[model samples]
Every structure is written in C-alpha cells, then in structure tokens.
Target: MDIKENVKKFIQSELVTDRKFADLQDKDPLISTGIIDSLGIMRLTAFLEKSFAVRIHDEEIIAENFGTVESISALIQKKLP
Candidate 1:
C-alpha cells in the first residue's frame, strides 16, 4: 500500500479504537477529531521515522506536518530522495 493508506491503517488499528470513524479520510483532521492527541503525535512521529526511514526532528513536528494523513504523506515524500 501507499504512504497515506499505510498511515491510515496504523492510526485505525493502533490509535483509533472507535469503529464509528473507521473510514478516516485522507484530509480528516486528526487532532481536532480527537483521533490523535499530543501523545499520539509523538507516537505517529516515531512511526513515521521508523516506517519511512526519515529523520524527523522535534521542530518539524507541527500541525502542518501531522494534521492529516495526506499532510504526513507529503512530509514523508518531501524527506525522501
């Protein structure tokens, strides 16, 4: 699967337990939707680093980069060669 799909799968399977929002869209607001919190952001950051082999610095972990699956995928893509 692609980056967005992989990220969505991880959030759905690991972070989000509620089945109501099972089908999380690409541009869905992760933090505002309560699907992700401060801790969840850190977890996601680590996941991005390990899964995508990208070095995510602390300063780069902003809402612009982690707000949505599409944004996160974009960040990962930007970091890649």
Candidate 2:
C-alpha cells in the first residue's frame, strides 16, 4: 500500500483501539482530534524511522510533520532521496 495508507494503518493498530479509525482519511487530524497523543507521536516517529528508514530528528517531530497521515507521508517522502 501507499505511504499514507501504511501510516494510517499503523496509527489505527498501534495508537488506537477503535475499529472506526480503520477508515480514517488521509487528511484526518490525529493529534488535534485526540486520536493520538504526544506519546503516540513518539511511537509514530519510531515507526516511520523503522518502516521507511528515515531519520526523524527531535526538532522535526512537530504537528507540521505528524499531524495527519498526509503530512506524515509527505515528511517520509521528503526524507527519501
């Protein structure tokens, strides 16, 4: 699957337990909507690092990068090559 889908899947499975989130859209706000928290962001950062082999620095872990699946996908794509 694509990066957005993969990120959404990871959030749905790892950060959330609600089955409703299985269909979370790409633009959905994860942290703003409380679907995930600060700790969740850390988990997602680690996941992105391991899954996409990107090095997410401490300063880069902001809402602009991890707020939504689309943003996260863009961040990962930016890190590649």
Candidate 3:
C-alpha cells in the first residue's frame, strides 16, 4: 500500500478516529486537531515502529516526527534505508 493509505489506516485503526488527516490538502496537524496528544504520541510511535519496522530512539520521538501523517510517512521512509 502507499504511504498515505498506510497512514490513513494507522490513524483510523490505532488512533480510533476517522480524522480528516487523509482529506486535508495541507498537512493535518494531529496535535492541534486533538487527534493526538502527548500520550497519544507514544501510541503513534509504537505503531510506527511496528508498522514500519523501524527502531525509534527515545530522543527521536518528537513532534516533528509525528506531527502529521505526511511527516510520519517521511520518517518511515528515511528509516527504511
């Protein structure tokens, strides 16, 4: 599946919210939208690690990495290589 599709599914299934993350023309700010928060970041990170098979270091878990679906996908792509 494509990155957007994977992101959409991850947000839907894991986040348990059919947010407009996939529909927005601009990057959806998950934190600002209340789609995710500090605690939610943990869940997102765990999901990304498992889904993308990437090891995220403790210091690497930041808003820049999980702020939006696009950013998260980019991080995954970076980690793949």
The top-ranked prediction according to lDDT is 1
Q: What are the runs in model 2 whose C-alpha is more than 4 Å off?
A: none
Candidate ranking under lDDT, highest first, comes to 1, 2, 3
lDDT tens readout by residue for model 1, 1-81: 999999999999889977887999999998788888887887888898999999999888888888899998999999988
Model 2 residue pairs with clashes: none
Error of 1 at 67 (Å): 1.1
lDDT of 3 by residue, 1-81 (tens): 977668767676767465455454327787678777777778877877888888989887778877777887887788896
* TM-score for each predicted model, relative to the true structure: 0.93, 0.89, 0.77
CA deviation > 4 Å runs, candidate 3: 16-26
lDDT (Cα, tens digit) per residue for candidate 2, span 1-81: 888888888888898876767689989888767877877777888888999988999999887887788888999999998
Screening candidate 1 with a backbone cut-off below 3 angstroms (N, C-alpha, C), the clashing residue pairs are none
Clashing pairs in 3: none
Candidate 1 global CA lDDT score: 0.89
